[model samples]
Target: MSVVDPGSTRGRIVAAGIELLGTEGARALTHRRVDERAGLPQGSTSNHFRSRAALLGGVIDGLVAGELREAEAVHPATAEELVEQLAALVELLTGPMRVTTAARHVLFLEAAHDPALRDRLSRDRRAYVASVVAVLEQLDAADPPAAAEALMALCEGIILHRVARHDETDPRPAIAVAVRGALSAPGDG
Candidate 1:
């Protein structure tokens, strides 16, 4: 099953790799598994990504790009607004995107041994943290950088907890509380 569109085929292969990584860990992220998961012919994955490293890099690229796009699409000017934004984000993390969350964690751990992947993950994490800082600044957070780091850590913890617990329902209430604590002001609402 060769795809006529090269770009779509690559995207599908990357998506398959992510799915496999999420479900079965790094050991299961073989070319054949990607092809089978993508519903493509045998060896198709190789034609697109020559090596496992390339495939893993593509998976990280796709994940970070999607997340960056999401961040750009949503902007909040208040702590309450940020919490409302987090409602949708919580739904995404605990719902259909749980596999993506799991795969991201897997790749993060793998990066410790792979410097190239570490650089990519580090760069992407910085971009994400910048977005969080922008939101924190808008809400007049006492310490935007620190607040952003804490919020990002909390968000990652949320994903880990949701993945391990296998609960798909929204975790907005917790997210709301964290945002409030991160951005709350004394003698002000």
Candidate 2:
């Protein structure tokens, strides 16, 4: 029999974990389920990721990478232009990106209980904040780091609100309001 590469098995397991995170949320994420979804032996998932937290860490990293890629798609030439970019990001969060962000929340809550997990979460979050700051800086926004931190908080808050209410109200207006507040001139600060 031809030997299947271990790397392929690892990829499949990670893919399965991502799908589970999106569809069933964190509770349904497990080695057995990931193994079954990936059509691999039950042991394969454990072999690749020794612990549940390890697997979750991988999923979080993947999700962050995906978000960074999506964020990159919205470019702004000026602080005013960044408002539109921020709106675009909010729309993306309120729509297709909802699963990723929502699932990330679940993972984040889980991380809170585990110091190792919390460290991973904090590092990934800082990276994301830095990416946002870089984008805002490119648009000549004053206090890009602070602006990015505020924007991330706004996005998370909007996601929580939308998820809890399940209401049809779009989050764009609220996000725009927050962004405008963040991007207000230094004199206003």
Candidate 3:
């Protein structure tokens, strides 16, 4: 078998962690599993990540980057159009991107007792909110600052609702409806 380069092993481990986080979730994420999935020596995972919390931080970073990329890629024409864009985003998030959200929730829970993990998660969340704000500004040519805050609030609400429900059913439809309503309502400002 071909040997994986030491330089690339760190990235491979992170990628493998992301994949595992997406598929098997936080509980399934282990250093051994990451090393095995990346076809690296057992020490590779420990050498790079050092701790499970750090590895989880890397995975969450990847998820945040993906979310920002998706949000940045879409530019809608009007407020209604923006709501539609959010709907599509929610659908993708609750569908293909569900694992990312799931992992995020798991990380949040784990962070309760882990200060390092909590800090990493808080920073990641702030970045995500900023990205969402940027997208909201682009979508609504007027008063984007306010819209961004409202949008972020809406997103948080949706996440909380979904977490509370624990995937008994898809939360996208309800979240989309709530977002659309909020976007149309003026009181949110």
lDDT of 1 by residue, 1-189 (tens): 122232598888878888898889999999999999999999999998899888887888777776677766659877777877766775676677878878988998899998998988898799888988887887888878888887778777877777888765565677787887788764555
Model 1 lDDT, residue 74, Cα: 57
> TM-score: which candidate is best?
1
Tell me the lDDT of candidate 3. Answer: 0.67
lDDT of model 3 at residue 116?
Answer: 84
Model number with the top lDDT:
1
Root-mean-square deviation of Cα positions for candidate 3 versus the true structure, in angstroms: 5.3
Ranking by TM-score: 1, 2, 3
| Worst 10-residue lDDT window, candidate 1 | 1-10
User: lDDT tens string, model 2, 99-162?
Assistant: 7767777777877787887888788777778778877777666688888888888777766776
Supply every candidate's count of residue pairs whose N, Cα or C atoms clash at under 3 angstroms. 0, 0, 0
Pick out the ten consecutive residues of candidate 2 with the lowest summed lDDT: 1-10
Cα displacement (Å) at residue 40, model 2: 2.6
Candidate 1: Cα lDDT at 76: 84
TM-score of 1: 0.85
Candidate 3 lDDT at 125 equals: 68
**Candidate 2 Cα lDDT to native:** 0.74
Give the Cα lDDT of each candidate.
0.80, 0.74, 0.67
